[model samples]
Each structure stands twice: as C-alpha cells, then as structure tokens.
Target chain A: MLGVLGGMGPLASAEFMRRLTLLTPAERDQDHIPAVLWSDPRVPDRTAARLGGGEDPLPALLRGIRGLEAAGCGAIAIPCNTVHGWFEAMQAATPLPILHIVDAAAAELARLGVPRGRIGVMGTAGTLAMRLYQQRLEGRGYECLVPTETEMARLVTPGIAEVKANRVAEAHAPLAESARALAARGARAVVLGCTEIPLGIAAGPPLPFPVCDTIDALARAAIGWARGA
Target chain B: MLGVLGGMGPLASAEFMRRLTLLTPAERDQDHIPAVLWSDPRVPDRTAARLGGGEDPLPALLRGIRGLEAAGCGAIAIPCNTVHGWFEAMQAATPLPILHIVDAAAAELARLGVPRGRIGVMGTAGTLAMRLYQQRLEGRGYECLVPTETEMARLVTPGIAEVKANRVAEAHAPLAESARALAARGARAVVLGCTEIPLGIAAGPPLPFPVCDTIDALARAAIGWARGA
Candidate 1:
C-alpha cells in the first residue's frame, strides 16, 4: 500500500488521494493500490518553519511517517512542497523510503534531458523563498526560474489558498498570468510544487507550458512502486 | 491527536473533517481540534462480508486501529456504515475505543428527550440487510425504520455505490424521497447510517425532517470527547 504523509492543507491531501486513484489502472477495486493517508493538520506550518517563525515540522512529519509504517505501508510520500524542505529530517525520522515530490520532478526533468531549458517552480511563499526546488534542480544541472517576489505574493500563494478553500475559479486569472510569464521565459515545463496548484489547474483551463504536476508525479511514482513490489 | 479511520470514500472523510472544523468554537487554528486521518480505501469490501463473498475486513480494520493507536490517537472513529456490522469483532481486535456511530446517534436522540421515538436509518442495501443499526437502536430503546426491500434495491444499494464512485448527486433524489417517507411516519430525525448518505444530503438542501448526518455526529462526538478529556 502507498502511504501519504499529508495535511499541509486538507485539500492537498484530498487532491493527492484523488490523483493516486485516477492513476491506478485497476479493473476491480482490490486491483487498485491500497493507500493510507496520515493528514495531521496540527503539523506546524511548513512556511512558518521556513520563515523561522515556528518549530520545525520534522516531528509531525515523522509522526505521519511512523504512522504509515506501522500501518504496514512499504513506502511513503509527502505531498506538501514546503514540508519537503524538511525531507532530510523526515527521512532520518523513519526507515520507510519516502518518494520525494521534488526528487520525482527533478528525475522527470533529468530523464527528459532538457538541457538549458528554463524550468518553472511554483509553490508556497516559503517553498519559493527557500529556493528548495531551485537549489535541488540546479544541483541536477537545470536552470530553475521561480515567480518574482511581487508575483509570488499576488499569484502563487493566494492561488494555493483559493484551491484549499474550494475556490478554484478565483485563482484562474492570476495563475494563468503566472504561467504565461514563466512560459515566456523559455520555460519547458512548470513544476506545480504546492499540491493545491493541480486543483487550480483542473478547475481552470489548460496551461501555456507542460505542467509537471509534482503531486501527480509523486502519486504516479508511488503507484509504480506499489505495483512493482 | 484524534486519528480518523477514513477513506471509506474520500468525500465522506473530507465532509467529516469539515464538520469537525465547523463544530469547534475555536477562533484560532491552535484552539481547533487537532486530528490525524488515516484514510485507507484498501480494506476489503464491507458489504461483501455480509453478502459472504469477500476477504475478511477484520484484519484491515485492525491494521488501521493499531496504526492509530501507535500514532497516539486519543480516540478513533470509522465513518463507514457496513463496516460497523462487524463492530463486535472490530472492538475485540483493538484495545482502543472504536467510537460506535449508532451508539452516538442513539445517545443524541436520548439526550434530545426522544428516547423512544422512531429513528429513521438510510444506508446502503448491505447495511439495511444486516439490520445492524435497527438492532442497535432498538437495544438502546429506540424504534428504527429502514427502507423496504424494493427501496433498498432501487434506491439505497445503488445510492451507496454512486457515492463511492464520487457520483453523489445520483443518490440525492432517492434519499430525499426515503427521508420524506420516514418523516411522514413520525420519525423525529433521520440517521444517515451510511457515510455516503451525507454525500447525498450535501448535494441537495437539507431534508424536510431533522437529519442527523452520521459523519457530522461522529465528528461532534469526537470533539466533545477530546475536549472533555
């Protein structure tokens, strides 16, 4: 069974589960991969941790990891982007191999061999501010482009929040503008780091560039791992 | 932290969480109830057990209960309807208190001074077929009314399947009709015995009679228990 470490925003947890189900190629219910989601909203805010305003989310993340492990999950995945900043700490907390969203997206980009291509990274303010994805991708030899400070405040953060609040329509105009700008920068694919961004994309129309939905990528990877095992 | 045994269906689990947030009188995030939801859709079919054609769900249910107990859940709540038919076995499997949905609803009725009033139950065909809620409510000194066999086949059975498929609107018309019939027969309140029943109710407006949304009742009871402790 695929175990999800979630509840960064309850909506994202739901989104991750939906993506997992849709990706599974099951003729019968039992044929589908079994999944256990530990959505602990009490986890200290990932953004707060990045901003140095709260305790590290490592403890809560580990709690989720251990919960899934105890539930007999062979492997685990954390859906939240900002939370993945504590990926190493969370990894150290549990023995279960966690499929990292950032790593999955990076692996996809690497596999594509998109040399010198502008890769867009969209996520929470903390995720972008920390340059977690940018740092990771740069190490993998990819040019990562993120939303500007003003755009981050105007577009990505609220877009994520709107989806969480089930107000996807409200996020469209700004998210489209963000996507358009990223595409204009010679971007090959926009990485939706925050899990909620996919909900916005689904609720809105198609994007300008190929949208590499990180959450979807993680879910697909999880499905692959579960099936392979 | 409160651990939720969920994903009997994703929507049902999300609805239960939403009701939990609404019922809490917290003005700040910290004041709100802290919860951990472990939503596993992999458990063997609850209905299939009663119908005698599936693997036992006891192992899977106990797996979740043990997971929650390890995760330090103060209490546990399962939002599935048919699964409760194995309530005795589940209780035996876990040392933790698995909050009983039927008992919660019956107690609410008793507290409302309608101890002996007629309580209408609307659930899947499997739930009604097992007579789980009927027996439990009667044992608690309440009269329970379930749908006719024909109604169960045409309305409730298909209704449960639709909700699992996330096609809840299809179940609304039939459920509202059933609710109205029970109300006419002097049912003080209708107990949405199936977790999916709330999905049908949420799709439309409220039923004409008092409707005790089972998922909502479970969350409320969870919050009270948490606070009292």
Candidate 2:
C-alpha cells in the first residue's frame, strides 16, 4: 500500500486523496487503491524552514514517514512542493520509496512532448529560492520561467497565503496575474508547483498555456506505484 | 496523535480532514491538529457486510486499527457511520481508544440543548437496519426518526449511492426530499448519520430542521481527544 505524508496544508492533502479516487478505475470501494495518510498539519512550515526563518520541518516529516513505515506502507508520497526540498533527507531516513512531486511534474511535461524551452513555475518563495522546480526541470533540458522577485513577494506569496487561510476566492486574482506574468515571459506551459495554487486556479479562466498540476501528476504516479504498474 | 480510519467513501474522508482544519483554532499549519489517516478505500464494504451480502469488513478494520496502534496513535476515529456498527468489535480489536461517531453526534445534540422528542437520522440501509443511530440516541433518551422502508430503499439509499459514485450534485434533491419527509414526521433536528449525506445536503436549500453532521461532531471529538481536552 502507498503512504501519503501530507497536511503541509490540509486542503491540498484532501484534494490529493479526492483526486486519487477520481483517477482510480473503481466502481466499488474495494476496487480502489489502499493508502495510509499522515496528515499532521502541525508540521512546521516548509517555506519558513527553507528560508531559515522557522523550525526545520524534517523532524516532523521524519516522524510522519516513520509512522507510515511502521504501518507497513511500501511507498510514500509527500504532496507539498516546498517540502520536496528535503526529499533526499526524508528518502534516506526511510527504506520505503518516496515519490518526488517535482519529478512527477517534470515527467508529466516530458510525457506531453512539449519542446524544451521556457516552462512557467509558480509556488512558495522558498520553492523558487531553493530552485526546486528549476533544478529538476533544467536537468531535463527545460528553462524555468518564474515570477520576478517583486511579483513573488507581492503577488504569489500572498496568493498562497490566501489559499492557506481558506480565502480561495480572494486568491484567484493574484494567482491568475502571476500565471499571466509567467506566460508573458514566453512560458510554453505553466506548472502549478505549489499545492494551494491549484485550489484557486484549477478550472476558472483559460490561460495562454496549458496547466500542469503537480498534485495530479503525483497522484497518478502514486496510484501507479500502489497498483504496482 | 489521532488515527483516522476512513475511505468508506473517499470524499467523506477528505471532508472530515477539511473539517479538522476548519474546527481547529489555528492561524498557522503548526498550530493545527496532528493526525494519521488510513484511507483504505479497499476495505470491504461496511453496509454490504452488515446486510450479510458481502465480505465482512471487520478483518480489514482491525488491520487498520492495529496499524494505528503500531504507529503510536493514542486514539482512533472512523468517519463512516455504517462502520460504527462494528464499533465494539473495532474497539476490542485494538487497545487504542476508539471514538464512536454516533456518540459524538448524540453529545453534540445534548450540548446544543435540543429536546429529545424526535431526532431524524439518515444514512445507508444497513445503518438504519442495524439501527446504529437509533439505538445510540435512544439510549440517550432521544427518539430516532428514520425514513420509511420505501423511502430508505428508494430515496435515501440511492442518494447515498450517488454520493459514493461522486455524483454529489444529483444526490442533493433526493436527500433534501428525505429531510423534508423526516421533518414532516416531527423530526426536531436531522442527524446526517452518514458522512456522504452532509456532503450532498450541506449547501443547497435550507432543511426544515437544523442538520447535525456526524463527521463534524467526530472531527471535534477527535481534536479534543488529540489535544488532551
């Protein structure tokens, strides 16, 4: 069975689970995939930890991974993008296979056969600072386009905050603007690197480029792993 | 930490987690509750088993409960109402404290100062046949009002099926009609006995009586237990 280490933000964790159900080809309950989720919302902030402004989330994340491991989970999926910065440490801490979210997104981009040019990425300030997506995708011969430091500080960060605060309606404008900015910079397609951004901009107005939801890619990959595909 | 054994229907499980975030008085991620959720959608059908038409869900439930116990969860919460029919068995299977969903709903009624004449209960056929909510609430001196046999077979059961099929919008009408029927029979307040019922009827038209969501009550109780309150 697969394990989900989540609640970096609770809604995203929930959405990921919902997506798993939708993605499964099950008519009855027993036909669907089996998963154990450690949704410890009390884990320290990922972005804050990355920026060296808060407690490191590694200890809490380890606790969750260990919990899943003890539960006999064979694989682990962490839904948050920023937390992937600590993916190597988390992976080394446990024997179970850990599915990286950025890798899932990058793989999705590759699967789409998009040319290796500018790919838009939007997420927490820490994600950008840590170059999580850029690092992952650039290795795959893709250039990453991100919001300007001013745009990120002013628009993207607050937009993510709005989603975390459950103000999803208020988040749409800023997130749309950020996506537009990335598209204006010649982005071929936008990768919603952060979990919360998808909650706001999932299906509203159409953007100039296709959208790649990391959660969707991760969920599909986790399902594939759970099903031993 | 609390262990949530869920995915009787995946969406209900997700809703329960979302409710945990909303009920908690936290401004940041670290301030919210910590929980391990085992959302094994592959668990045998609770309602079908109770009706003697499917595989018994007890072994799977025990496996999940044992998993939580091994993971060091101090207490457990199962979001599905029908599963509570096996509450005693589950509690005995694991040494961990198992919080009963019906008991939480009953406690919420008492806390709200609602008189004990007629409490409408709507859930799966097995939940109603097993008289899960009826027995629990009646023991607390509250009369339990259920849908008629025809209503249960026709409106209530199909509505629940619609929700499990992820047709929540189509579920609204039949569930609302069921609520009206219960209200017509002198139901003081409706206990959305099943988790899916609330997801369908939570928004739409206002019901004749105040609706008490068992999932909400269970979430609050689980949070209290987790926090040592």
Q: What is the DockQ of each candidate?
A: 0.23, 0.59
By summed lDDT, the worst window of 10 consecutive residues in model 2 chain A runs over A202-211
Model 1 ranges with Cα > 4 A deviation: A22-29, A92-94, A103-119, A136-143, A158-190, A197-213, B7-11, B14-34, B40-42, B51-56, B92-95, B103-119, B136-143, B165-190, B200-211
In the predicted model 1, the residue pairs found to clash are none
- lDDT tens string, model 2, B1-229? 7788988988788889888877877656667677778888878878888787899888888888888888778899899999988888887778788889987998777766674768788888889889888776786678988999899877888888877877778889999999889988998888899998998897487775688888899998988886784
lDDT tens per residue, model 1, A1-229: 7788776766667667766765666533455566677767678877877886778777767767777887788888888888878878777877888887887887655555654467888888888878888877886677888888888888887787666555667877777778778878878888878877876777677875678777778877888798788
Cα error of candidate 2 at position A35, Å: 0.5
Q: What fnat does each of the candidate structures reach?
A: 0.25, 0.64
Docking class of 1: incorrect
User: Model 2: what TM-score?
Assistant: 0.92
TM-score per candidate: 0.78, 0.92
Residue B107 of candidate 2: its Cα lDDT? 74
